[model samples]
Structures are given as C-alpha cells and as structure tokens.
Target: MTERTAKAARRARVLDDIDLRLLRALWMDGRARVRVLARDLALADSAVSVRLRRLREQGVLAGVHAEVDPAVLGLTTQALVMIRLSPNTDSRAYEERLRTMRSVLGAVALVGDFDLEVHLACRDMADLERSVTALRDAGAESTHTQLIARTVAGLGQALLTEEEPA
Candidate 1:
C-alpha cells in the first residue's frame, strides 16, 4: 500500500466507540472520578484508568483546565479581534507573544482576509485599546475589533457530540 493510504488507515483506527464516549464525558467534567467514569461508561474502574492513560499517551487528550470567569478577574468587557499582519511578519511568533498577555484568552490563526483572531477579556474599553496598541506594536498591520454581546456556545461545542472516528 502507498504511504498515504497507510497513514489514513492508522488515523481511522485511533479512536474506538469507548474512546469517543470517554472523551465526551471528560469534556463535560474533567474532574470526574475514575469510579464515576467507569459507572458511566459501563466499564471496570481499572479499564477506565487504562483508557484514560492511553488517551493521554497518544496526545489525544490534553491536560484538563479550569474555565475561569472573566468577571471574577474584574474583566467586564470581552472583545474579538481580527488582525492582519504584513506578509513578512511571522504569525507563529506573534501568537506565542499573545500567550504572555493577561487579557488574551485565546487566539486562532486564520487563512482568509485576517491572519489572527484573538479573544480578549478586559476590565473595560480602555483595556482593550491598550491591547490593540500592543497588537500594532507586535506587527499587526491592521486590526478590526468588535465587542462581544454574549456567548451562546463555547469552542468545540459542535464537535464534542460527534461519534468516534471511523
């Protein structure tokens, strides 16, 4: 078989039915106990533990993280920033810098008119302006920002309910 075909076959077999269900359960509550997960998945506690370890080892499951409330951090304003940089700028380096910013919740690399989409939680509009200024200094050629009125769903909400890989 060709290399491409073999790679596709390997990707298809990565996750089975039990892995999908376990992923869904963990997505909802990362802190769930092994016993609780075993009960939910109809598996033995030891089996659940083994599956979880395998998932982590395969890099399929990143570490669990707490979803913090921006309000609790005194951040009352939320904005989505669409940024475009000069063709010569390095997007990966800029993304890494964004990780060091206190207001940056997350950032995505885009392929269309925009180069990056950044989610920011700030104390107020003034804080957002500061972030915009920093973006320009960091090599953003142009930026368009919009205030987020509300969030109906979070990232990966749609993908979370899908079945296991074929």
Candidate 2:
C-alpha cells in the first residue's frame, strides 16, 4: 500500500466508534456536560466521564477555550505579513521569535517568494509597523504587510461556519 494510505490506516485504528462520537459531540459544543453527552449518546454518566478523562489523558482532546472578540480588547486591526527570510536565517528560529510576541496570532512557513506568513492583531497601523520591524530584526530579509479588510472565515471559525459551495 501507499505510504499515505498506510499512515491513514494506522490513524484510523487509533480511534474507535465511541471515541469518534465523543470527539464529535465535543466539537459541536466544547463545554458540553458529561451528563448531557451521556443522555444524548445513551451511555452511562460514569462511562461518558471516564471516556472524556481518558481522551484528555491520551492528548486526543485539548482543553476548550472561549473565542474572545479582539475588538473588545482594543485590537482593532488585523494584518497579514509575508516575510522573506535571509539566506542564512533559520525558519524555526524566526517562528520561535514570533511565538513570544503577544500580537502575533499565528505564523507558518511557506513556499515561493515569501518564506513565512504571519497573522497579527494590532491596535492600529503603528502597532502593525512595529510588528513588521520586529520581524525584520528577527532575521526577516523583507516583509509585505496587508491590512485585512474583512474576515469571511478564519481564526477558528472555518469549521464553525458552513458555506455554500462556489
């Protein structure tokens, strides 16, 4: 069999029907109570609780969190940064630097003209400028920054919102 197919088969064996059902229910409602899930799934409360605890222990389920509105925190601007790294720069080192910055919402390595892409939530244009400067100091050869006009689907909402196929 193909390498990718073998990997998929191995992953599939890791989670069974009950595990999938619990994960799906949690995905739908992160804070769902064990009793509620038990009633819905027609399982015992103890069973549901045990499974939930096991999932957490196995690292299958990460802790749930509330999605806070950035505007409420005075973060009024979202910027996308495309970074070109210097030939001698290490992408992992640059990414590590970004991880420590509070304004950086997300960062990823990429291919082509830009070596890295980062998402920033800022208070204003000045904040964005400073963020770009910091990136430059952190081994970015150059950067192109764009202010996000509107977010149609992003920042963990892609799975939450269903859209009609184009």
Tell me the spans in candidate 1 whose CA falls farther than 4 Å from its real position.
Answer: 1-12, 154-166
Tens digits of lDDT, candidate 2, 37-153: 999889999999988887777566768877677878999999999999998999888888998998898888898999988999999889888888998999989999998998774
Model 1 per-residue lDDT at 58: 68
Can you give the TM-score per candidate against the true fold?
A: 0.85, 0.75
Candidate whose lDDT is highest:
1
RMSD to native for every prediction? 3.4, 4.3
* The 10-residue segment with the lowest total lDDT in model 2: 156-165
lDDT, candidate 2, at 20: 77
Q: How high a TM-score does candidate 2 get?
A: 0.75
Error of 1 at 61 (Å): 1.2
Candidate 1 local Cα displacement, residue 36, angstroms: 0.7
Cα-based lDDT for every prediction = 0.87, 0.82
CA lDDT of 4 in candidate 1?
75
The deviation in Å at residue 19 for candidate 1 is 1.4
How close to the true structure is residue 145 of candidate 2, measured as C-alpha lDDT? Answer: 90
**Candidate 2, pairs of clashing residues:** none
Residues 32-137 of candidate 1: C-alpha lDDT, one tens digit per residue: 9999999999999999999999988866777898988898989989999999997778988888889889999998899999999999999999998998889878
